[model samples]
Target: MVQQRSVTYVNNTTPLSITTKELDLENCVNDNQVAIKIHSAALNPVDSVISHAANKWLVGSSLKTVGMDYAGVLVKRGKNVDPKFQIGDKVNGFISHAFGDQGSYSDYLIIDPSKQSAIGHMNNFDYLDDDVKARFSDFDINASYPLVFGTAYDGLFSNGQLLNSRSRILVNGASTAVSQCLIQIAKKHLNVETVVGICNSKSFEYNKKAGFDHLIAYDESNCLEKVQSIIKDKFNGQKFDLIFDSVGTSEFFPIIDTILKPRAEGSLYTTVAGSNKLKYTGGLKEYVSVLPLWNYAASWNPRRHYNYTYTMVWPKPAIMELASLMVSKKQFIPPLDSVYPFEEFQTAMDKLNTNQAKGKIILEINKDY
Candidate 1:
């Protein structure tokens, strides 16, 4: 039996606490599954978030691999595996499931597309078999898109309700990878008229390259006041169609009534930021002060005027295909921040945990690739 080195952890630990191990590559999977030799993989913020949760609500042993996005060549397949996915086919995407043992940090991975691919969101939604298959000569770059871009696409459409080309949007944490994708998709695909992005002062030009029409420096004082001023001046007191919080801050949410259109007006305030705004500047203080999770039941109130929801990425075939098509047409660009060798994963995680990376941080699993 062959053996491979993989990153492993017991959870509830800091990113630097993660360790490595060797596993015998024996009968990795069966039935509608394929084994892949990963060439590249991408790191994400949620990687540490889930790890710190220590398998809460997820069943896993003390040991599990770590990673989500990966790009590789198929090496083996189960008997019932789809004929369309043959050995040697190059593919890349992400695994988003309730389990952690099946991570992509290793040189080898076994995935059951029907369940772990996040396609159709664990088959909860409809997805195509080939939706996750997109290859590029640069595996590091390919490894970056599936998670962030997919999240952006889902955040925009899954709950976006009835947005169209004329829609206007406000994106917090505009420099975030997912936010950048959101700006681009809303502008180029949906043809949104005006898209405003909030980032640090230094990233104005950088965020603009991601298709943000207007950029604001959140680092400045009275940021929300400026946001309100824009609403009053730019649209003549018109509310924004969408207020997306990518940095996890609820700072814009409480004042959303002034910044967003009402439910009656078909407007929404959606955040990917979870409970805390996770400003990162305040560290634990920020995490503890994260916003209260929005409840759907709140919408039951007859007097309710605002539509608000929190969403995470759910893999959908249509969205994945659209992204893939856009990539092929060069209509979508996934920003790349830096690459780390497999051995330097801890350093990579350090950067990611800072929430300071301008784009995706990739791990070149197969350095030769």
Candidate 2:
């Protein structure tokens, strides 16, 4: 039997254990599935959220693997696997934890082509532009790109409908990995002229260089007042065309009407973080709280003509492909706050819990790979 190391979550009280188990090739790698030797895995907040509170909702069993984003090499291809992908191909993407079967923090992963979200091939360094190539040069860092980028892409282009070059955008939690991607997309792809980012003073320089035209430091004593002031002063009193909230807090809801653009067609306010309240609740309470909060946000100020929506990255291959193309062309740069060896998984999780990581945190799974 082939055995591999995996981080398994049993319960909140018990420490996450690294267990050795036989690889269930037959069950995990089904028709149209591609088996991969995971090289590195990236950490996301949802990993800890689900592990601590929502575990049973996603994984019926008490013991389940934890992780979402991964970059790896294809080792086996099911008979019906797509021709475009072959054994030995290096790929990066995220898996859905909602199903609860497997996760990216493992020696092996099996992805069903028909069901998986955003898996794509990485181009060789020779083909990549020199400036952006160094980032992807490390498989550990490359592993961090897909999930946050996909979430940002879907939030901005799909849910927010930020289609016009004239659109003025504001990204809350501007220092987050997803926000960094959103800032880049707004500037490079959408070609928007005015891009505002909200973060602490420490990240002001980072976000500014990432193409944010204006910065609002939320740590200031009068943060909301400052946000309003920026809109009035820099934007000529114009409301933002779209507000992408990656922080998921309700802090902005009360003042959204003041800063958001009012359009008869409805200005869009999309959030990757659904509701701040839901994050603290668990089990039936969490499930029950989600809808009402969504409703409250959606109808909060209808008279202002702005619509509120929430989004999660649902793994679209096309989005991953588009991101790959942009990265190859030096348009999208992957952001990384830190990388830890697989043995230091707990340390990596600790950094993610701080909510202070400048970018994504990744675990180098197979250092040799």
Quote model 2's TM-score: 0.89
- Window of ten residues with lowest summed lDDT in model 1: 120-129
> On a 0 to 100 scale, what is the lDDT of residue 287 in model 1?
49
Sliding window of 10 residues with minimal summed lDDT for model 2: 276-285
Model 1 / residue 57 / CA error / Å: 12
Q: What's the alpha carbon RMSD for model 2?
A: 3.2
**Residues 1-369, candidate 1, lDDT per residue (tens digit)?**
566767776644433334544555557778788888888889987776555555323434556678888888787888887676788777777888533577878888888866655431111112212332232236776677788888888778887477787788998889999987888788777788899889999998898777777778888899889889888888788779988878765576578688888888888877787555564324333444664535445656678878777777875566567776666555676777888888889888889888889888988888554
What is the Å distance of residue 126 in model 1 from its true position? 30
Q: Which stretches of candidate 2 lie over 4 Å from their true place?
A: 24-28, 54-62, 124-137, 277-304
- How well does candidate 1 match the true structure in TM-score terms? 0.87
TM-score of every candidate relative to the true structure: 0.87, 0.89
